[model samples]
Target: MKTSKGVKRRRVEKDGDAVVATKLRKEFGGLVAVSGLDLSIPKGTLYGMIGPNGSGKTTAIKMIVGRLRQTSGGARVLGEDSPLSARLADIGYMPQEMAIYTDLTVSENLQLFGSLYSMEREAYIKREEALLSMVDLSERRDSLVSQLSGGMKHRASLACAMIHDPEVLFLDEPTVGVDPELRVGFWQNFADLKARGKTIIITTHYMDEASRCDIVGMMRQGKLIAEGRPEELMERTSTSNLEDAFLEYSWRDSV
Candidate 1:
């Protein structure tokens, strides 16, 4: 839990219990998307994935969630293979696109997804109320999704993902179209979830926001260029911010 003279440090456990990947790889025809990559996320930790477009960040996430089959690799989430029957109920996934039903009312949409996991109506009702209020959308409980603004739609999507109360949440670009004010609120919500022992893994292009992560994995061309706390990466790269540090790391990696 120590850092260099100019670096800030955050405490993260390096215990045996974690979400892990070893030699993870994916390919599409002649193209190799993710190649021999390894990642480990500790339980109850906040982890970030950062990279330029086409750097295989999305591919990596897809594999972790079992949406894409790996070409040659392996992954273990919460001590079991991802997509295994036992892990299905413990993982909540929020994709990059808004997955809400445009025609359904907020409550109806929640009920639809909630029921998919066999969540009882009574349990779903209780969670629905708490989640709706948490995201400041209680008044819109009966509004059709198409009536909400872009930010509100994102909020609704987040609520739907959490309705079943999964222990691990995978958010791919959760703040894409959110405004600054709402973005701040979103991070605050993430912090609250962390305090409650929920593990969050998110992918983002925003450098400033990436600093909020307990640990970050900077990726390039399907390979991990660096992995560490934000401040540790900055100090190691002799830079003041994540973007600059990423550039420095990429340069050194190429050399």
Candidate 2:
């Protein structure tokens, strides 16, 4: 691991991976939300999880991020047991729901999150400025989150998540209700993050967005039905696009 200006960089294991899960399972009473799911994400890469509404993408992310415990199996994030508080500073998570202070201004929300990580005033300000620009919310810095549009709120939430500059980011449907232009910007930022050596794990239902990921995992009924680069999966299924490839995999899984 390397350190810069008091920030700890990711520890590169011999395997050069940032996240690893084996047989990860989650159950809610009789309902298996996630079952026997496996994942291996490399450093400095964007990995996407694509599945329908009930496919357990959120459940799996919660387990991996330590917000929710798994019923069986385990995972290692940043080379530590999943969800270790000691490693919290190294990870950032953006849930499907907006997780921001509704009454606070965008800058205040970013400041609060930065304070949570004990960032210094100078560092927080610098990061806040950069993040606001990245999310295209620089002009709305002082606008109360409640007063912003849904798309603006979503962007603010993303800025809050990235304020700490975590090495690993877990984003669940980050572009849910955004317009096409903003969605394009979001993917562009994701690529920039990956270039900066950040490992991003994103869950999205959009086939077009999934195609931008370095690798993608398709899930169904709490199980991962297929995994590959979007083009590779398409080729394997003899399909022309990811949507068709995903449908083919879902059909195969059903049988």
Against the true structure, whose lDDT is highest? 2
Candidate No. with top TM-score = 2
Which lDDT tens digits does candidate 1 get at residues 1-255? 658644432223334445788899998999989999999888778999999998898888878888889998888877788655688788888888878898999989899889888999889889999999877789999999999998889889988888898888988888888888878988988988888898999899999999999999999999999999999999998899999999999999899
Q: What is the per-residue lDDT of model 2 for residues 50-121, given as tens digits with 9 covering 90 to 100? A: 999999999999999999999999988877898677888999989888889999999889988999999999
TM-score of candidate 1 to 2 decimals: 0.90
Deviation from native of the Cα of residue 49 in model 1, angstroms: 0.5
Give the C-alpha lDDT of model 1: 0.87
Model 2 per-residue lDDT at 41: 88
Worst 10 residues of 1 by lDDT: 8-17
- What RMSD value applies to candidate 1? 5.9
Task: Please give the range of 10 consecutive residues that has the lowest summed lDDT in model 2.
Answer: 5-14
